[model samples]
Target: MKFQVIRLRTLLLSAALIAALFVFCLLGNRAILTVSGQLQQHGTPLILIDPGHGGEDGGTQSADGILEKDINLQLSKKIEALLHARGLQTQMTRGEDTLIYDAGCKRMREKKVSDIKNRMAMIEAAPDCIFLSIHQNYFSDTACCGTQVFYSPNNEKSALLADAIQKAVITAVQPENQRVIKPSGKEIYLLYHAQVPAVMVECGFLSNPEEAAKLTDEDYQNKIAAAIGDGVCNYLNNKQS
Candidate 1:
């Protein structure tokens, strides 16, 4: 009587628990499959976004204590999201704030060299991929502020891509920007040696107090990311036609 009722109740509870778990897992898997399908259906050739200067090397700094590495990472992430939303396949170098050097490299100089070499290897591995390196500029004259783009000199597509991105940024994000795209010099080892189209975006000058504030804002960062995404889309569309 009473004992039989308790046993039946326990069995019912266990069955309910099992059914709930099954439903949860089923829904989760379906969600993953949907996203995977979306990515595969519209994916483009890989676009590698490298957020420059990580780990111990904090590239540049502003008067207000903002670090360039942090800014680069934040902006890169935003750009990645925007590009993905537009159905573009994207990859990142050093997704976090860490130097991606070979494990055995010990000294600071050795690590820096290893980091760049490792980055170059990634670029070579995806030979057909486009590369976008995100960085901030610092000048002795704080008054100098605007977005400037540098492209690999040897690749004609690199120049076109840089020009498109610069134009997009100026028109969409910073109307006052008047900077032009230039050929990357030998100082940028990765860009100079890159076989594929490569461009480095100097987002803004951290040396300027006003521009530094805008760079740190979430809204402004999204605008910049959207502008970059538009530029990449424009370049890709133009390349196809």
Candidate 2:
């Protein structure tokens, strides 16, 4: 009888420990979920993604005929997906390979101006938003390669955003990249006029054959998007902290 009582006490103690462990795990998971939800609800900033040129304006072209507009849209879509997965809010100036110009615009130049104006309007419409424009770079020399970032001069925070993206891309993929972020001049219409924090990512030089090949690759574009996404998230988190 004494042995049986001892065994029964041991069984009771084991069951109690298991019950306590289950409760602890349940509470821990709930705490994690709550923190995640809070960050999604309050910590994230609205990101306005503008994929550079489209339609008649194909921007730059690779030696193999890959269009910069197409690559920009593709990479922007990937970045949008990454941001959404992280529970962040995002809006795109153009989702398809079409210009966001006013219907009244007729000539090519007029349409181009209208498209840029409309994109700027979108950036201004959002409250406390971050503007990220994706584009491909080109130079007369094919030797010029690697990603570069440009920031709007209107806002001080734009430089910080640009630095984050430039560093993130180099650290994540192009370890050899030595290019630094530059301030946008009047030449870049959108960035020059943007009132909110804005940065344009010149993803790579389409003029360079080797870089062009990598830019056209779907896998490489995804990696670029992921790095940009990480940079945006890191910037926002740091700002919040």
Candidate 3:
């Protein structure tokens, strides 16, 4: 009876040791995850998302009467949510269909220029931030379609970001899309003169009837937003490595 009690005590001790080891490992993993999250929050730059055109400027319109500005804002908001879920910071240029120009500007043209300048100033102030302008494309040739990303010429980092986003969109949303990343020219006011890394994502060609329909779909917009979030995370990871 004495020998049996000793064996039972030994077994109980062994089980206790195993349980203690498991707890230690669990705490160690939690500590690592916390540290990892901190690093991610520290290293990743805030994303400045600009939903192009608003108010008087309806931007391009599809044959079905869908407005580009509305679609841009919707997609931008979706992307912002995904970024937030991934623990990344984000800022939006405009949350509603209103002009951001100074109150002094009364004329429509004056308001447009002032709004653009204000956006530029915001970009300049946030030197470490990544700028993403969401817009839809319109072409006389309805044959042209697919999402295209344009990066600022002033920054090499913009090209890398554009490529990452473009690849993500193609891979996740449209596997058949063969669109390539292009550099912004003088035509793009914000991208042409940006001091920080910037990319304008042309979500889709509104000129194409089929693409326009797809762009209006909520599910499709969500997929695009999730892909963009993945691209941003991937870019940040690569930068850290």
Model 1: per-residue Cα lDDT over 116-235, one tens digit each: 998998888776678999999999999999999999986789999999999999999889988999998899988999988999999999999999999999998999888988999999
TM-score of each: 0.82, 0.82, 0.82
Stretches of candidate 1 off by over 4 Å are: 1-43
Candidate ordering by lDDT (highest first): 2, 1, 3
Which stretches of model 2 miss by more than 4 angstroms?
Answer: 1-42
Candidate 2: pairs in clash: none
Q: Each prediction's Cα RMSD?
A: 12.2, 13.9, 13.4
Task: Please write out the lDDT profile of model 3 over residues 1-241, one tens digit for every residue.
Answer: 9999999999999999999999878755443222113322336677889999988888999988999999999999999999988777788889999778998898989999999998898787666788999999999999889889999999888998998899999999989899899999999999999977899999999999999999999999999889887887777788788
What TM-score quantifies how close candidate 1 is to the native fold? Answer: 0.82
CA lDDT scores, all candidates in order: 0.88, 0.89, 0.87
